[model samples]
Target: MSDPRTPRPTRNEAPQWQSEDGSLILAKCEDCGEPHYYPRVICPFCSSDNLSWITCSGRGRIYSVSVFRRAEPPYALAYVTLDEGIKMMTNIVDCDLDAIRIDDPVAVVFKDRNGIPTPMFAPVQG
Candidate 1:
């Protein structure tokens, strides 16, 4: 069972979705006009193969949240529904762990992951 919270292995053949600048590229369903997180060959909603890759605004509202205190560096994880209407599993950083809550506005930021830049969300300032 693969964890949805973890990014897929960086494959040379993987779809060019995430960029080094922190903005996320996602698939937009041509049929239903719904944007989805986590790159895929087909739309999960309508089962349509017609999808377009586009950069999201990288801002979203926290739909849910969880805090893990056992790790070396405790962290907050969440399901954020991007302004584009896609919910993605991501870690929340740069803010106090106890301060994050559902409906908190967040912005995406790039963090180092295995020497590669990965997208992580943080509480939006002001």
Candidate 2:
């Protein structure tokens, strides 16, 4: 089976939602007013079809993390809890591996992947 963490192949067609600045696009339910990640046509919370896209604040805190020490350059996989109450699994980058901690404030950043913008997180710089 393919690892779920692996990103899907880039689509040939233009995305329905595109961000020029690499900001997150969130799906919000018009009925319940709850925002969710991994935008879906139907709201996961209320099963409402009235969903709309919104730009995310891109600020969150690390909920959990695992460092892959065996990887050639080392990397971290983490679940981040966004300020809007959505949690997403993402890679943490641009910081010392030994210093990462749960609840560390993080901000979204994009990495270029075969011409597609992939979202990742890094410790917020002061």
Question: Lowest-lDDT window of 10 residues in candidate 2?
Answer: 9-18
Candidate 2: what lDDT?
A: 0.80
All candidates: CA RMSD in angstroms?
Answer: 3.7, 3.6
Provide the lDDT at 105 for model 1.
Answer: 94
Clashing residue pairs in all predictions, respectively, total 0, 0
**Which regions of candidate 2 fall more than 4 Å away from where they truly are?**
1-6, 9-17
Q: What are the TM-scores, per candidate, against the unseen true structure?
A: 0.82, 0.84
Candidate 1 lDDT by residue in tens digits, 3-121: 34445544421444347666677778899988776767778899998988778798989999999999767888789998888888889999999888899899988786654567789
